[model samples]
Target: MHQAPDILSLARKAPVMFNELELLQYREQQIPGSVQYTIHRYRRQSQFEVDDMGMLVYHRVEKNSKENYLELRFCISGNTYCRQKEIECDNCRFSLSNSCEQKSPSVDVLSFLFSPTHLSQFINGGKMKSMPDEIVHFRHASSFSKTLTLCGKTRTVLEALLNHNYSGSMENIFLNAQMQMLLLYSLECMIGEKEEMAFTCKFLANESDREKIEKAREILLQHIGEPITIKELSRKVAINECYLKKGFKELYGTTVFDFYQSQRMEHARYLLYEKGLSVTEVSMMLGYSSISHFSTAFKKHTGIKPCELLLR
Candidate 1:
């Protein structure tokens, strides 16, 4: 029987870049233990890299040094560890977790790991606190989740990055700016979550509360096609309407209705491009009242009309 390689052993050989590095190449490899990861190093200065992984995960990792940096990762597909120390994906699309030596097998994710100093300057003009220091702990504390879950704007930036899936530095300059936007949007998400915690309440550390929040988000997404209010969603999730509104915003970084609309447009794009559905069909399937309304919403979210995507 062939033995699979352990997580650490594979990570040791997970491609290392030393000194100033400039390489824009994509590499995919599967270790003996069925550990498959595709890595691409895009920018040298920022040390930008995107990793798309597969299941076969590591729950508890051996401790190791994690340099101070901000990691912005979007869950393109498949589940990854987020709230629980155990390996699981919960209900998260974009997650901003502590990028440390100990990592997870978060399949189908786009990650950007850059120095905290470089990001701190641009993120709110260095006014933001919680900048990762050289000696930072990766464990969760107080009311913070292991990874901050974000929806809407952050996920949109990630989907845009995925569109430029070519393997090279052809548009390094433009991609760099987009990467900056990723950080900015993520910063906005984290700041809003923090404000909710610090100003609004304390003892917000109940594991059960986290579950209810996740369930509320799931219910909202499940009913994206149909119009559902916060009160209705709260009732379905067995949580209070006020907590549902505030907690959903705090955790996912968007209001209930905003997240629903964003998700509906995203699903519509998938149907139009992948499933090859017509604009009207897609809109109707999504429960939109009129084709014009759907077109307007799609263009507003994607910066282009449904018809335009087909042309390209």
Candidate 2:
């Protein structure tokens, strides 16, 4: 199984490369501000290709030459826009055949990229009878909240895979199993729309519910530094408070309040461990108003006081 890098130790290994020119270009165009960590740097004119599955991370990808193996790109943290065909600007797609393709007006995002072989293996005997044009159509349209929910789940699995580095450990196997799940999910969303299949429809309904709960979670994340109430979350998502609470708990396997608190504590842990922020500073930043309350909560969540964690 994979373990996340000791971020503090890795920080000392080498600072991540940042592209100032890219940042300026995006900023000048009024694009959404995005902070990037260059997890892998491709050397100029590199041409090596391998068939085996490998894990990699990149900032932005562009296809300058004829494509080799089919590429799958999944967004782990942020949003991306791409078309079926290549365009000159960022978020464009092109077709080698016919030389005519549509510029992607939006992004196609998932957290994991699967090679053609991998995808073929998934369908068993290379039969994708269920997913024809609809697969691309649904992905491009961003229609069906079910699709987005699956994308988020794919991201989670990808995160696990990257952290584990394809090890043969039990955790690695579990991650791979989850990846298989994401594949089935995408397949279901694609073909399920075309047919009235009972199982597929059932899965789609479940996915839709999960998507709603995720929206609620996103709202909570946006307000992590401030106190967020269930009513507030329900109002923001335009769902009834009672249903929102029930759905949030069922989808996320935790109550909305519990999940919200976990997110805040996790954010605080990142600040303390990664940014080396002082306990008082973190407490204030997270809107505790009182350091004593912050410490109590922190200790309850992590089984260690904020100050003690900082010492470690």
Candidate 3:
């Protein structure tokens, strides 16, 4: 007798790769602004060729290429994993593929490519006074690579496109505005990162407080299934409630509740898409009594509807 395999277990163990099939659906859009970004969207399956000679291939065929531009990748939804080579600006070919050991249904990635000249123009045009020294140092350095976390407002800007999902001149205009906003927010985050590093280097005295806040963060994650008040969390960590609230934001750049809720939705996304959980099931698991409320929260966190993800 054959038994049905556990799809959820398979999902957690499989790798999500961007095979040639994914890239075949690539559509390029004229990016807005003087910086001249080129956006490539992969919407459907790959278009890889199968050799009629009957060659047995078990893995995705590797493709090599060189890049002369800066690539900004936002894993908006689905599998949040990719395999990318180290940034080599000298036109050297290297592996460019992504795979995650998780059963992923679909993925939506927004890529913005920029030439070095255009990058300089963007910085100068946007008033580079606020950019951090890391950028400045990289401007003169031989090689550099950076990974930045997108803040809530930046993510919201990306999500708002859901309300105006269309394909036309209006779409271009709206996307242009959103791109400009994302770029500005990116610079702002860099500045904030620099300020944080400076403060950390200067204030060795606040180290203990920083550790306590981190401990509180772990407790919040462990008890995500159940809601906990600020007072309760602070008591567990032996920190004052007020200090806990303030330090939570000061350390992580978001309120405690916001952070906790955001984490929950990100987890919810994985469960709904990768684990193949139904909307009602996900809502109940997340402690939402109403599916409408769960849908709203999911959209808020991911910029699209729960049903939309399921459809994809």
Candidates in order, TM-scores: namely: 0.45, 0.43, 0.40
lDDT of 3 by residue, 191-295 (tens): 576566634322223656665776787777766567788999999988888888878886666899987887688668778778899999988887887999989
lDDT of 2: 0.47
Q: Summarize candidate 2's per-residue lDDT along 104-198 as a digit string, tens digits.
A: 12111223444333433433444334433323222221111221223455555555544342434554456556656655555554454436533
Report the lDDT tens digits of candidate 1 across residue range 1-312: 111122221232232222223333354542322123344433323323333221111111124313333344443432223333334333232343444333333324344545433534433433323622211222221112224455577666655654454435444544566667765665555556645665242323565676577667666656767878777878887878777778777765678877778778877877887779899899899888999999999888778899987665
- Model 3 poorest 10 in a row by lDDT: 52-61
lDDT of each: 0.51, 0.47, 0.53
Report the number of the highest-TM-score candidate: 1
Candidate 3 runs further than 4 Å off:
1-204
Q: What's the TM for model 1?
A: 0.45
How high a TM-score does candidate 2 get?
0.43
Rank order by lDDT, top first? Answer: 3, 1, 2
